[model samples]
Target chain A: MTEALASAATEDILREAAAWRDAGRGVALATVVTTWGSSPRPVGSQLAVDQGGRMIGSVSGGCIEGAVVKEAQDVIADGRPRLLDFGVTNEQAWEVGLACGGKVQVYVERVE
Target chain B: MKRDLLDSLMQAQRRGTTCAMLRDLKTGGQGLYINGEFTGDFASGPNLKPLVLKAISEDVSGRLPEPYQDIFVQVFNPPVRLIVVGAVHIAQALAPMAAMAGYGVTVIDPRRAFATDQRFPGVTLLNEWPDDGLEALKPDRRTAVVTLTHDPKLDDAALSVALKSQCFYIGCLGSRKTHQARLNRLTRMGFGEADLARIHGPVGLPIGALTPAEIAVSTLAQITQVRRAKPAAPQSAAA
Candidate 1:
């Protein structure tokens, strides 16, 4: 069931990215390419962001969407893809909100 | 001209066809593969073809081989469907639950009063006879069919059609005696014991369900169990 939802989300991300590009809005896509330990979302899960910071779908359930969206804005601006790593840090665990103690690698690229 | 890969993929999804999209990370090339053929223009060579086929067959998405490590293959499969024959009380409950579980549900009953939009909101309602409705739906391997109308005139036709199709689950609501009689009838209709065994008559897990909603839960649970059961697992041995 989670897989099905992820697949649907991937499709939605692609559709939304294409629509944003067609409408002349800068678009970038962030995909969960790899994860270690108890990541909330699985690999292939995606989150799409347009120039105006409008977003759809998710790479992490909730722990790091804000961070991804923040980075996605940079990817859309510079047109340079970025690889982001998020994990629990002793002092920053509370700040990152990743209490589950897992690491996630996200690949954010401009959809051009 | 670069073809719109997303548009093509959306079309394939709407048409219920299995397809895969492969993307190269380094070079940013993309290709759409469908029905054993590659349609879009991409730079990945023939070496990655087998991996694409494997991904589609497994219905999974992941990175490619060593040389193509940067590439990603994403698979798309049609949505699962559930067909409930007989707009009985159980159907009213099961349809919504199945829909919530991501199944496209269709309720069929010849009785107009029973098969109504009011009774089955947001479900596809067919006031046609069972056999005709099943024929039209053409239940496939991704489909689950449940017959709740105890009347053989309705259930027998639904069962016959579902049994012959590739539907993953087929259940009929009845008691043990009624199921035995149903098996006898189906046997007379030339269905072998092996074929009849595929059915879960006296449908639903024996959870001591007393109400319509509880029965619906049991039925849906049994269907999900059958749907996800690993075929290689020994069934009788587990029992």
Candidate 2:
């Protein structure tokens, strides 16, 4: 069931990214390429962001989505992909509402 | 090129066709595979082809192999369908729950009053006969057919059609005695014991369910159990 929801969400992100690019709005996609310990979302999860900060989907279930969206803006602007690592400390985990410590690797790329 | 791939993918999804999209992160290349046939051109070399096929067969989405670490495979299958061949109380309870579980539900009954929009809102209501309705719906492997009407006229017709199809689940609501009678009737109609074995008579898991909603839960639970069970070896006709 989780896989089904994640698959559907990824499809939605791809479709929205395509739509945004077609409308001449620069688009970038952030994908969770790897995760260690108790991550909310699994690998292959995606979040799509447009130039104006409009977003669809989630890579870390709101824990690091804000940061990913921020980096996605840069990727869209420069058309250069970058990998981001988020290793949350216990205090940071509490602040971000994650249940425990974990690390997530997200790859952000301009959707061409 | 991306637009064309997106268009084809959207069309395949709308048509409920099984497909997979493979995207290479390193090169930004994309390939679309629909029903085992490749459509768009992408660098899915021989090394990664089997993995893609395995992903499609399992209906799962994940990253590719070590050499193709950057590539991701996303699989899309048709939505599961549930066809309830009666507008009984159990149908009323089951339809909504099935819908909540992401099934496209259709409630069929020739009796107009029982099968009403007021009773089953947001469900596809069919006012035709059981055989005709099942014929039109064309229950596939992703479909589950349940007969709640105890009447031989209705349940038998629906069972005849459902048993012939590749539907993953076929459950008929009845007591043990009633099911025995049903088995005898079907046997008289030329159905063998193997085909009869597929019908989950006295349907639903034995959870001491006494209410309509509880029975619906049990039925859905049993259906989910069968769906998630590992596939067994194919039975030969002579077996």
Candidate 3:
């Protein structure tokens, strides 16, 4: 049902993250640690990525997800968490389509 | 984060518990905050005390101040609940309004005709004695209890349960003279002035509300004021 899927999407991102980890795959969680004005996603919005490039949830809605996913892959590989800054002063903000012009700081950490 | 820690957080979420997660970026130290119970790799830091309390109180997620600037606190809270212990006219208006304000509203009345789904559509209806219904509900600190039935038997039974629990707000519909009489009865029933003081006598702000909707607005505004003015987390929790 649509309700079940929607609830899973909104309420179970961490559940999916744990599921992937339990299945013997490396998992990474990308969280919007902080935001400065007009950002699409509020602080604590999260994206979960597995080793095979599969990702669930959205940190920046649509914008900056690809970049976060790339960083998540590196976090999974190195087991070293990363803090990514986007928008305003970051040149990659334009390339990544963080079109809102709001600054967002994302913290990506591997689930070990 | 440890798999066990993630499991703990997931378990709390499943139980509709309010909690928080803290992570130190520099040290990779992680902690979980639950009803002042701290657990995890970084639980022992005294400086994390006030930050965790403030973070959960405001339902905010952000970094700590300098010295522990890299520490991020993420809060998770369940929906607020409002238990209306009557299906009267005020409840009819209040239920929908409180739901719009993001409280999961429930209406309780033993009279089946009054507590009908037709009268209170989309609200959880409980056609049971007030005491039994409230006992089953187990109102937590995020819950608000309001008794609107003028009958002593119904209001007192609900008040007994509401007084014993940690509900953030308690309001009863009555005039000042009626509330004084009610307080006398409750006093004889073993409640002290300290416990009775929690009840908002002649409930709702003194806006001279003439209509049910206006009274509901005043009552909801009073509840909001009470909740905002008090510390969301328990006081004596710093230890």
Candidate 4:
């Protein structure tokens, strides 16, 4: 694990906003639209990652955040909104930090 | 629309006030309405605002205790506060933690040298005596006061205000012996034993902490426990 403990998910979201502002890029907000079983983050949990590789917010238990961040940067670059879904099967869920067979669907859109 | 209302609610929370956010959860995507204003993308009828406001006022005043009251009202505007009656190392640690936990932290100490914005950045530092500062604070159910001075004059003065007010958590940093002494003195000063019981002495949880930072973490854990017990509402405020 990294030496730094994970920050409050809220901080992650705002940092993304600042990054967008700093880099003169539009922002895309991603939110957890659905969830099932024991999940660290609840529905409506949001992460707004910008094109400048800076992020603020979290959607998974530190599992899907990196993936979400990547998609967010792409959304910023393309200026097209998309709904990215993850955590369907058991194996898929395990890859994204969802243990205990919990699946969460995240909706990512570029809403500047 | 949801974002706008949430931002307004968070603004009120940052100022240590309560606000109501109404969300129509029946639909697939919720519509957030704040203070009777149709702030969402989809507009409902005009009368919805009055109805939601009535519901919110009643819920905040405790006239309604329905199961979803927490979701409907409290989470929309969570209480964020910091009551520090002393300027010490423990207060140094506690102030920042409280801020990190989304509290609008305020520090009170008569010693101007001890309490300064430089010592505790991003916190409101009051260079007034505890009693004077607390009187201005008007601690309510959302406020959390912690005393680290171990000086009776400062602790007692603030405790009097905190116990009478609606503050939920009252903690004084002291050992077992000091706590007993505090209780005895407060009892003599006309405070009931029950009131004394409300104050958490030895301050934090029994985490065997020694340093100021560690102790701050333990105190934060205890404070979070109280916060979780009273899940305010589900509205997010912008920092």
Candidate 5:
């Protein structure tokens, strides 16, 4: 299931990337490298964060979207990529609304 | 990607197969992209378009696995389907317009003369009674059934079946008075008030659509909106 969802997610990112490239708009890709605790989606989930921080997919439910968006925009601005993680416990998860306790590690990268 | 699966999907689509395409949206390689009837790798360069076109057009055979298959299906899958139960002029215009809007259109009418290929050129023409046809068609969550016949016999069967099943959208062509009368009939037949409410009588988005073509467009637009609108956020955003 992870592989299938990732595959489609990747396709969507690539397709969007192509569209952005064709339109001459900068884009970046973010992947969920790892996850912990109760989460809606699993690891390998991705969110294609564009230069404008407009997302094309999701990495975690809404738990880490804001953080991911910030990271994506930073990646686009820096023209470099970085990996980030979030929600290791109730305190950190409180901001993202993860039930019980859960966490996610995301890898944000810019692709040509 | 599995060649056989792609073939099955395309073949089903060409033959108007009624099934949902479940796309996996979280995986792919280097630069693979998928649009309806097209799947190509960014690394492959210019050759990708031709490859995808050829693959969709020809009787290709393969089984798609995990992410790639899901993406292929999502990009190519027919989301909401419009099954028009009448062969009116409105259907003629609506069928093509709906197709253009990415809907898998099926026009069903017992009148062979009315529901001809000429009338709905590119549509999946089914010359059968609405009820019988719908029974065989089996309306699912992704299916939307519309009754333009305005005739009780034809429209009622569809409404009955649609009300019983999980069909997402069910609309009938009628005026306020006609709709009330239809609702009364449905009530008499033991349809609950809640069930009767599902019918979108006076179909179409109150866009002041007058002509048959205009009405068709209005109906299609409303269906599209209903299909794409995201579900409201519940208490939890876990998944």
Candidate 6:
């Protein structure tokens, strides 16, 4: 059997975010700034996105990444950050909320 | 996020220095907070630095408290550390187990034969007196200490250092009788009831583990319980 590595550290994601910027790709970093209830990812969990539609890391297990990526690309285009809130109680709950019914505040900002 | 600032933050992170990435939600500006120094476009006054510092030290990442509500402090703490004093069969099982669970494991034993690379390949082996070995490691808030030598000379010295420091977990392997005797010794040595209470005598979840590997699993499981389990009700925060 293959050995399972330890939990992937935040350094790996941040390093990838930095490398993308250095390579001249427009990258946007989405960080889960806050979480309430049963969030799969912790408050500091992140999702890195490039303008090319590639992504790394995650803000939620799998439920909210698509919406966060779309918002991230917008931030990359405008060079202005935006915060997206998702939860069972939100107005856009059905379309983008976490399946685990957790609440999270994701701050998306373009990497300069 | 500025390229230079990200580079500097990564440099600090690589060096195992605690750092925080701060963002002003109102302005969408991001910066790095490392070693009490702020590097970024946003102005971090006296009021903001301590909040970031608190977040880093507490290993909590979230919005700043009242008055500084606009900032989000994202803490990046160094790896959680585990120091096992003994390097015996239990340690041989425990060291790699703890490492797999994301703890930076260090095994301390003055006996070179016990603390060797043959037994512990990637684990940090400190073949010094337990107290001296622990002191050199400079146990911090993120550290966990376990004494399994079954020798008071080694276990007591390690306990003295661990109890006095902010390490999150202190476990000593011993039975009820041995634990009571250990407590008596520490009490006589000037540790009060509150200080002595921190030691997890028998040092593992009471699953009646018979083998060294099973004991290691129990100990590591207890460490996880202490590390991840919240002290109070989660309901209040969710509310």
Q: How well is candidate 3 docked (DockQ)?
A: 0.19
- C-alpha TM-scores of all predictions: 0.77, 0.72, 0.61, 0.73, 0.52, 0.84
Q: Which residue pairs show collisions in model 3?
A: none
Local accuracy by lDDT, each model: 0.80, 0.81, 0.84, 0.65, 0.65, 0.84
Which sequence of candidate numbers ranks them by DockQ, best first?
A: 6, 1, 2, 3, 4, 5
Q: Write the per-residue lDDT of candidate 4 for residues B112-184, one digit (tens) a residue.
A: 8888778887778888788888989889776789888889998899998888887879998999999999999
Give the winner by DockQ: 2 or 6.
6
The lowest-lDDT stretch of 10 consecutive residues in candidate 3 chain B is B228-237
Reference contact recovery of candidate 2: 0.14
Candidate 2 DockQ category? incorrect
True contacts kept of 4: 0.00
Candidate 6 backbone collisions, by pair? none
Worst lDDT 10-window in candidate 4 chain B: B61-70
Backbone clashes per model, in order?
0, 0, 0, 12, 23, 0
Candidate 6 lDDT over residue span B1-239, tens digit each: 77777788788778878777888898877778777677785554545876776676567788888776778888777778999999899999999888767787899999888989999888899999988999899998789999999999999999888888888899999999999999999999999999988899889999989899999999999998998876875565554
Model 4 clash tally, residue pairs: 12
Q: How far is candidate 3 from the true structure (C-alpha RMSD, Å)?
A: 8.5
- lDDT comparing candidate 3 with the true structure: 0.84
What's the TM-score, to 2 decimals, of chain B in model 1? 0.83
For residues B86-167, write the lDDT of model 3, one tens digit per residue: 9999999999998776577889999998999899998999999999999999998878999999999999999999999999
What pairs collide in candidate 1? none
**Of the candidates numbered 1 and 6, which has the greater DockQ value?**
6
- Candidate 1, superposed: residue stretches over 4 Å from native: A1-25, A34-43, A51-54, A83-105, B1-3, B39-44, B65-67, B205-218, B229-239
